[model samples]
Target: MKQKELQIGNLTLRRPIFQGGMGVGVSLGGLAGAVAAAGGAGAISAAQIGFREPDFDTNTVEANLRAMGKELQKARGRAEGGVVGFNIMVAMQHYADYVKQAVKLGADFIVSGAGLPVDLPEYAAGSNVKLAPIVSTEKSAGVILKYWARKFERVPDFLVIEGPKAGGHLGFTGEQLTSFDEAAYGEEVKRIIAKVREYEARFQKKIPVVLGGGISGMEKAARAFALGADAIQAATRFVTTEECDADPRYKQAYLDAREEDILLIKSPVGLPGRAIRNVFADRVMSGERIAPERCRGCIKGCRPTEIPYCITEALIRAVKGDRENGLLFCGADAWKAERIETVQQVVDDLLG
Candidate 1:
């Protein structure tokens, strides 16, 4: 079968492949720009993006906005005018500010998740940047669509249906994730796609539907495409790429991981996330939850006193090359990656 372009709102993606947005400093200018330059949509993850700056925790909103603009500009330069977007989590501390900043900075699109982005259209109004919501089920999709339609009189430019198999902070419960039934979820995807198509007709616009979470390799991509997905977003595979913004040691963790080592753990943010079972994870499993000396208050519902450890600190440690103490997030197939690969090679392999 021939590949098809993904048309999201007014934007056209030559390849139906999106670089899944990794948080913190993982998917930033370098990786996102490279993906875009290679003819795929590059999604810059804006979750804790300011972490790279020395005084990020104390930086003013204006300063943070300025930094975001610079990063987007740098990515655009490397993309050579290809499509570049920002993935902003709705659950972030300053969601509205980040959304406004990305739009003001000329982001081509804003793909938001971690919570229902009911007011996404409001923030994106009067901007050329397209808006997409990352949903995990038909119920979530319906809720956002209904809310947007009734309250904001808007519909998303596109939709990303993230399955339970996806890495990082997932949308499913820990037990649900372990016993997830793809047969049931596959039906849910069809229903959500149909729902979006209903709005497509009502609004006289085509709203592309993309699938994320656990999508890896050519076969998986093809399967998703066959299942009616307009595009597939891959994140874990990209982590091991040369263009990935993560530290070498971080990538090495994925390359060296085993199947059993990839397990679900509780995140301080009150969500069950998938990560490699390393020393840090072991500690969490061992019931030795220690609070960080300093609290950034990143997540909305984080309970420092009750939580085992600070997610920010552990993730930062991993990004900075502390493999033992750092939290290593990965997809189930992370162990499949045996060596470091270039971005182009990874893309081509998926496209093939």
Candidate 2:
């Protein structure tokens, strides 16, 4: 296959891969910057990004906001002028503030989801920062695009159509996942692309569609592109890379997993997340409840008592190398990762 660049609005990336933003410090400057250095668009996650800060436990929001600039600067510094962006979820408090901060710090784009980012353009208004929304179905794609067009008289720079096999906080319901049909979903992706083209033609700008979810390698990316995707955004494949910010033990967990070890877990954010089944997951699934010492205020409606467990703490534990008791997020095909490789190698394999 001949490789191509992903042109989103005015920004151009030689590699069509967009590194999906894994949270709690998974895809920080090191991983994101390396991807950009390898000619792909690297993404830094804004979820509890400041967990490493000393005062993060006491001052969650402030620490997170403060760390945003530092992380973005670090990523930009290492990107070598390649495309770099942030992934800020809509469920975050003051989501617009995060968006504006990214634009203020001169980010190239913002990929948002975890809920529809209806007001995304409001904060990005008058700025050159491109905005892209992650969607699973055509209805959501229509809702956001239509709202943006009606309110801001604008359209997205690009769209990420993530399918059911994605890891960590999926957009589909359990019922939907059980009944998921690829041929039907492919038609859905096509429907969303048609809608995006409608806006693209209206604004006389291109809205490249980057499809994700279980896009494990070259063959999957090729299939998605054949289904109308202009680019690909992969998260799990990057987790096992040498440049990825995950702890070595955490990466090893992916290497050790089998097909049956992959399981669906519930998130505090009220979404189904795909992860490798471990001691922690077993405890949760068997009705064992654990309390968190403090609330990071990471999710929209997260009240510690009513939830399964503190997602922030679990993800933090996983990223810091605690595997047995930590939540290990991975794509459905993560068991296919047999060894650690470089970001360049992963890119080459997918686009080679």
Candidate 3:
């Protein structure tokens, strides 16, 4: 099959691929810009995006909000007019404000997940920024689309299906992730697409569906297209790319990973995630809990004293190359990374 461009409203991405948003300094403007310049849509993760800002420790909110615009600017500088957007999680403590800020900064699109972004339209009101809600199952998709239609009289510009094999915080239960059945999941994807089509028909507009999670290469991408996806989102595959915003050591971890090294972990936010097994993860899995030294108030309803470990700090450490002490969130196929390739090379390999 020939490569197709992903279309959302009037926007066009030369390659039907999305560089999935990795967080805590992972997918930043540099990486996103490179992907967009390479012909695919690029997404900058808004999770703790301002960690590198000097005032982050003192004025976390301000620093993060400030960083958002700066990151968008950086991406635009390198996007070459290609599609570039932000991936903001609904579970964020300042989710509403983040959405509002993103629109104010003129983000081309905003893809939200980590919870049902039911009020996303409201937050992005009066803006031309396209919106997308990330969902893993048909129920969530139906609920979001129906709610948006009833409440906002609109449908999403696009939809992202974060499959069970995705990294970081997942939408699936531990049981579901452990007992994943590809054929069964493919049926789920079909149902979700069908549900989106219902809204598309009602609104008389196209709503592209993008599939992600464990999209390691062309074969998996082909499966996603077979499942009715208009595009594929890949995070882990991008992590090993030279343009990725992560430190060299972070890329090294992916290169060194083996099939047995990746494991499913329970995140502090009460969600199951995939990561590379290491000392930090092993310690936590052994029933040892460490209190966060400081609270950035990143996630909603998260109590610093009650969680297993500080996700922000751990991810920061990982991005800075402290592999043994930080969280190494990655897709199930992280072990397959053989070397650090350029963003253009990876995109061509996957979309060609």
Which prediction has the highest lDDT against the true structure? 3
- Estimate, for each residue in 1-352, the C-alpha lDDT of model 1 and write its tens digit: 4477777666777777889888777888889998898888898888777676777777634445666777788789898868899998888877888899888888899999998898888877799898999999888999998888888877888899989989888988998899998778888889999999988888888788888777778888887887899888999989999989899999988888988999999888778889998899998988896778677767778777877898878888898888999888888788899888887888788877
CA lDDT, candidate 2, residue 349:
91
Model 3 weakest 10-residue run by lDDT:
1-10
Candidate 1, poorest ten consecutive residues by summed lDDT: 58-67
lDDT of 3 at 331: 94
As a TM-score, model 1 comes out at 0.96
Residue pair clashes in candidate 3? none
Q: What is candidate 3's lDDT per residue for 7-57, written digit by digit as tens?
A: 788789899998899999999999999999998889999999999999999
Error of 3 at 218 (Å): 0.6
Return the TM-score for each candidate structure: 0.96, 0.98, 0.99
For residue 148, model 3's alpha carbon misses the true position, in angstroms, by 0.2
List lDDT for all candidates, in order: 0.84, 0.89, 0.92
The Cα error of candidate 2 at residue 351, in Å, is 1.1
After best superposition, candidate 1 residue 198: deviation in angstroms?
Answer: 1.6
Report the alpha-carbon TM-score of model 2 versus the true structure.
0.98
The Cα error of candidate 1 at residue 259, in Å, is: 0.2
**For this target, which candidate reaches the highest TM-score against the unseen true structure?**
3
